[model samples]
Target: MASLSSLLPAPTQQVWDRDDERKAKRVGSALVVSQTSVPPYGQRKGWVPRAEEDFGDGGAFPEIHVAQYPLGMGARGKESTSNALAIIYSKLTDLLPSEVLAEDDPTLQKPDDEDIQDITEKTKLALEKLTNAKISAAMPVKAAPKAVS
Candidate 1:
């Protein structure tokens, strides 16, 4: 019998455990947050005074912010709303028995031969009807008579 690990990709061979070590390591990394503001320039004042340390071109803010979170955590934010939903979904799915999960999934079931034939016939009839309708709706074009040289 083949081991379950053998069935998984090499990188994911060891990720089947309840608490994935890789996920834990990722969660352990520090998360940093920063804010940036672009000062407006006026004819009289030139550029508004900003803290020397806080000042940066528009590009620096995103680079610093991305380096801090790296995984686009900013979109998701600290609330972890999506993460919580994902965890809930995973838990719900895990609670279902293997047989229920496998059998209840619509994509796993194959259509009967009769069902396939019926659908194919219906699709062909619909296409034919549409083609006929288009042909009927088209206006006949008259070719201009050739002029004598």
Candidate 2:
């Protein structure tokens, strides 16, 4: 199989775990809550979390890779290529489980359809709250007026 880098140049490869450099590393934010941040300016700014730095122990967290698509003719170019790589990284990272569990654990298997629906509904509600908080956090701060000289 062709690597994501094969699709473009200067691909940004992030590792949630550094155990192996040859394979992809899944970055799970749930693993490292305290280290996460949203900085201004940059590919991941505004809620972008760092790979290994933001994720927790490798033994527990799962990893995924997400890449972004380009917007113009240069979409296939270097910068766009990097952007695509980042998109892929994000997608992959997002799919990872919050924590790894034993295979023998029955809880690891998918639940019944009704359970699934219930889980989905709960997830949606949780996401709604999280989104609201995130939007509130992203709001710009107002500046105080200066006195005339």
State which candidate has the highest TM-score: 1
lDDT of 1 by residue, 73-117 (tens): 443445664554453544777777665466667788899899899
Tell me which residue pairs clash in candidate 1.
none
Kindly report which residue stretches of model 2 are placed more than 4 angstroms away from their true locations once superposed.
1-109, 141-149
**Cα TM-score of candidate 1:** 0.26
Reference-based lDDT, each prediction: 0.56, 0.53
Identify the candidate with maximal lDDT. 1
* lDDT (Cα, 0-100) at 138 in candidate 2: 71
RMSD of 1: 27.6
**Tell me, what's the RMSD of every candidate?**
27.6, 33.9
1-149: candidate 2 lDDT, tens digit per residue: 99887888763786455565434333532555554533433444234233544333322112224332222323344444346445353476677867767998987787889998999999999898787766666766554233223
TM-score of each: 0.26, 0.22
